[model samples]
Target: MLEEEYQPRRQLPVHLRPPVQPEPVFEFTIRDATLADMPYVREIYNHYVANTVVTFDEDAMTLKEWRTKFSWVSKLNMPFLVAVSPTSTVLGFAYVSPWKQKAAYRRTVEDSIYLGPAATGKGLGKALMKELLARSKAAGIKEVLAVIVDKGAEGSIRLHESFGFVEVGRLGKVGFKFNRWLGTVLLQKHLK
Candidate 1:
């Protein structure tokens, strides 16, 4: 009898395999956000809110609501930064918000970062976070917290961890989205 060659099968189908995403071709300039950047900023965030479980919000926020939120951050004098391309396109944004409304939480801020669909997989997110953290430290912030979705957020967790953030806690099944229960992972970086 003739021996036959063995063949291996792929667990993931070809169409289901992850796509090869190229690194950004353009360099990014990180800077403090301005009122003019709100539209682009909102656009990036709405993309995540609409398409992914990355954000717990199931519905996309209106521009008016986003502007209000931005105004609030500005009023608090927190750092709201945007990564712009050479052409002035907003590639991503990172901001620090009060962790809670109480005065006791004033020194602690929660970080929220959103990258344009095309801007991800590049170093923009990390660069933005570094700038935001530096600014927060300079502004006398004591701690920065990141509450990230457990699923589809490994990159975010890794980015935070790379910047000295450690996982402080995890909340299982705390969110329901896309017909499934999702968890949250809380990470903290002490700046003081």
Candidate 2:
């Protein structure tokens, strides 16, 4: 390995890389989300909205928007939770929303998990997801779905699949953002 022949390694995009560590032993508490967590939650999600294709939303969400969502999820009694650090900072958040408004879809929900930029790649995602699934099942959710971005979100797809979520369908090029077309990968898990 001569220095002259050395080439810098090309790294995969951040969102595409899998966590290198095994089952994260990090310290974080998963608890119910409160109105006080809205600002942090908004900041975490809006980062993806503004800079990444992980989320189809191009505009950064307002705190008001997050508050409304929090209210709605609370009303549904669906497990809306957050990961808090020992210092009480919100490391991340996860929640489920009704998959559809129809009566027949009442037992089905879509799960969403997002972590702060500084909190990523540390296994917070896996912890959040494990708790979210347990809570979802206890909440009487028969079906859980993950609608993930087709590109720039491979890690999320892999995380869900690791938890028994399977690729049920895909919608190609349904969203246009950042001057490019994007698609969605739909993953589903059925609870016993």
Candidate 3:
């Protein structure tokens, strides 16, 4: 009689084994931001400023500048949201601000989304952006603009497109960063 072929069972190394206890899914809460959230907000923003082309600013913002920004947004009664975990750790933030300083631009606001390094790819940015847009609509914002860097930001471009923002313009070589010139893509979603 032919003996059945024996198959060896593969064993995973201890470190490669799946965790016996699964980590609990992180819980997130989205809410209107207050003065107390300024530090966390600034930290998240500065993370992008220091590490990415999400903004063209070469220098990180000081706490005083962040505070001034918060004050300005508050005075405008614009929408600002913070995503927090159950323990109140800020994961990300989104807000709407005047697109331009001119009075004619009052109804047009630029939207900004910033996430902590660890908070990306978990849908937190999308959630925050949705809430921000809802609040902007309720506040009578006519146009929502997204000014995005054109270099390797396909994810951001896709996200805005998914939210009904259409590419309205592209400015070439408008930004200098990372030892090279970069372009800017402007997307707009009409709210009114």
Candidate 4:
């Protein structure tokens, strides 16, 4: 094409542009999880399993499996909590499990938190973490460990760091998911 025949790029007028939708601002309360909450919890967790690398789980958890896990954690005297909306709708969940089964590791625990797809990025994660840490401390737990996938969990790392969790170590290519190698960042915090 000749320079004289060149045309300038056309820009869509403001009226023709798509509207930007804002994320919803949700209100919820965090409380101890019940048997009924396990199904919702499973859905939230399975969302991550099927869609993201935040968790290395390749298979979705069933209600029976989640129930067993709930029972086990309850038996250990650990807190399993959920965030719920005004109508008792489960929006997210957080819990602590024994860091290691050995007797010597009784005072240490690992935290796991997950939010429903519609309930993420609205500060509910922090709220759940705050309550989880408090309950962990009250349960005589001294150490909290977080094992976060390195590639897609930067938000989780920052969240843990903001709560005074320090990076203890990292293992490279320790997890394989989505047909690719993934690493982990290990962070630890001690309850005072």
Candidate 5:
């Protein structure tokens, strides 16, 4: 018998090992937000507000302030949607607001989408946006704009681009957060 050549099994680095698959924790349902959903929605937004320059706000919104915002969006007949779990846990929320306080800009809206840190990277954002944009079209919206932070938001930029948004403008070093300068990328999408 011929002697077999000695070969050793290759060992992979610990970091290069296959990732642990996360369990399916919840099923999300996208629907118009109710007054009851405001608190959870505020919680999600406050996460970003407190930790990031995403909203340029350093303070959290009080319940009353959240109510005022809900009322304002309702007054405009804008869609304020939430993604919820089967047990009624809010995973994310999205809405549209006036891009500018002028009659000429009434048909154009600025969209904001926020997801709980745990709820991201699982397609919840996309689902909420699909419902949001559909509602916008039904509400006669002509354009939708997204103002995204460009520092560490590549996923956000990619998501918007996947939905046909085009970068129309960029403001460099326009925001300061965590002792570092940040930039804003403005993207727009037109609906027919």
Candidate 6:
């Protein structure tokens, strides 16, 4: 009997597998929102109201309420921006609204930003805020204020600080959520 020569199967080295690279963070083009964007806008807002401390409101606004809200912002001539991809998916939104009901406060607007859970931490919030501030200044807004729930949201505070926002006030135990009272910190960036 002749013994057959044993052969080993060829194997590629471990390093030969293409080195895995991190996914590139998504980029957004900020633009004026249209009626068609209401659904997406609602989705983003509701996401925060449901899952985060970014917003104090516990109840999500209905579509009709959202429409009215956007309409009011438009009437103020304030910028309402929807951060969208090339495919037109709204990842997040930002806007300025009347800081107070008094006419003397007309020049000051409160700023709000909401991002889908997946959209956070990729600089979408900062981009949206930067564009919103530009539009606010163009429209003669004097001050931009952010009321933040201060549960150590360092990322958000840092983002605002990077844009010249300074802490102006803090109200302790003003917000109730998740079976606890949360403090509210006011951050303002003056454009004028």
Residues 65-98 of candidate 2: C-alpha lDDT, one tens digit per residue: 9999999999988999999998899999999999
**Quick one: RMSD of model 2?**
8.1
- Score each candidate by Cα lDDT: 0.91, 0.93, 0.89, 0.95, 0.90, 0.88
TM-score for candidate 3, please give it.
0.89
Instruction: Output the worst ten-in-a-row residue range by lDDT, candidate 4.
Output: 17-26
lDDT of 1 by residue, 45-103 (tens): 98998899999998888878878888999998899999999999999999999999999
What lDDT score goes with residue 92 in model 3? Answer: 87
Native-referenced Cα lDDT, model 6: 0.88
Candidate 5: minimum summed lDDT over ten consecutive residues — where? 1-10
TM match of model 4 to true structure: 0.88
lDDT of 6 by residue, 81-139 (tens): 99888888998898899999999999999998888878888889888888999999999
Worst lDDT 10-window in candidate 6: 1-10
Tell me how candidate 4 scores on lDDT.
Answer: 0.95
Residue pairs in steric clash, candidate 6?
none
- Angstrom error at residue 97, model 1: 0.4
Off by over 4 Å in 4: 1-25
Scored against the true structure, residue 184 in model 6 reaches a CA lDDT of 84
Error of 5 at 30 (Å): 0.8
TM-score between model 2 and native: 0.86
Model 3 error, position 133 (Å): 0.6
Best-fitting candidate, scored by lDDT: 4
